[model samples]
Structures are given as structure tokens and as C-alpha cells.
Target: MIDISASPTSTTLVVSGDLDLAERDQFPEVTARVTGLRRQLVVIDMCRVTFMDSTGAAFLISLADSSRNRGGAAVLRGADARDLFVLEVCGALELFRIDRDHRCDDVPDAVEEPSIV
Candidate 1:
């Protein structure tokens, strides 16, 4: 499942469970809310995501690319070893803005409120 939230200055997407072939297509819907923002900090929390494949990595990389085009940044947080491996194999580890020190309360603007399901 996925939970999305937005603060004054940032948007956060928390993804748990597995991100394999079955879950790969869910990226667009999850990222749609933040892809158009400009100068916004987008945080994708994958700390709880148990499994991820190259498809998942590609989706994330694409999402991050889209955000960058709009002057926003996509920060990936808490990617475990398996997920990290996919990213590394794809040579996408350096493409994203990794922020391990991100704090939820630290927002800079007021964005639309997010939801969880």
C-alpha cells in the first residue's frame, strides 16, 4: 500500500510492501500529485518497502526525472539493500537526491494535504 502527504513545502509518499512487476504500474498514480510542482521537495519513503525490482527502480528514476524537469527534487529515503541493488545496477543511485536526514516536520511551504489508504 501507499500513503501520500503534503506539508507546506514538501510532498511525501510512503510505500510499504513489495514493488515488483505487479506493483510497478502504481507509480504514476502515486507520483501524479507531486510531479507538477515547481521547486518542491518530494520525499519518497521506502523504508518499509520489503521488495523492489528493476521495474520499481525505473519507475522511481523516471519520477525523479519528471520532478527535476519541473524544478523539483525527488528524494529517496530508507532504500534497503535489495532496492539499493536495483538502483545501483541501473546506475540510478547517483541520479537522485538522497536525503537520509529528512524530517517530516521540516517543511518550507503549504502544499495540498495528502491522504493514506
Candidate 2:
């Protein structure tokens, strides 16, 4: 599941559970619901996401592109190492602005889960 909190200039998406194709069906609706008419910095907190597939990667790419088109940036935080590997293998790491070293000002406090379970 994903919990979205939209502020006036930013939106925080707390992603939980597996981000596989089976669960990506709600991605569009969730984004549409959380995104307001005005531009917003989209911060995707993947602290609780356990797994991800190629479909999920594509969804994230699309989300980032869509947000950028609206003059907003998309930030992915606390992505699992496995997911990072997937992106690396797919040569899609550049698509997302990974928030590791420097975090955007609008990013909410993201308590990352343990990578090893």
C-alpha cells in the first residue's frame, strides 16, 4: 500500500509492500489522487517497499517523467539495494533523482527500513 500526503509545494508518497506488477495497478490512481493541480516536488519514500520488478521500475520512470513535465521533480528515497541493482542492470538509474547524499528541502523525514530482512 501507499500513503500519500500532499503539501502545497510537495507530496510525500510512503510506499509499503512489494512494488511488483501485481501491486502496481493502483499506481496511477494513487498518483492522480495525491497530485494537485499545482506543481509539486514528488518525494517517493521506499522505506517499506520490500520488492520491485521491471514493471515497478517502469512505473517509477513514468512517474518521474510526468512530474518533470509539470515543472516538478521526483525524488526516490531509501530504495532497496535489490531495487537499485535492478535499476543498474536496466540502465535506468539516471531516470530518477536518488536522494542519498543530498536530500531536497521538501523531503519529509523518511525512516528507512533495514535492507536485510
TM-score of each: 0.76, 0.77
Write the residue-wise lDDT of candidate 1 on 13-117 in tens digits: 888778778996677777676664443677888766768888788878887787777777788776655666688789887766665554334333312222211
Tens digit of per-residue lDDT, candidate 2, span 66-111 = 7888877888788757777777677777767777753333435444
Full-model lDDT for every candidate: 0.70, 0.73
Candidate 2 pairs with clashing backbones: none
Q: Which ten residues in a row have the lowest lDDT in candidate 2?
A: 108-117
Candidate 2 Cα outliers beyond 4 Å, as residue runs? 101-117
What are the RMSDs of all candidates, in order?
9.1, 5.8
List candidate 1 segments past 4 Å from native. Answer: 36-39, 102-117
- Candidate 1 lDDT (Cα, 0 to 1): 0.70
Score candidate 2 by lDDT. Answer: 0.73
lDDT score for residue 103 of model 1: 39
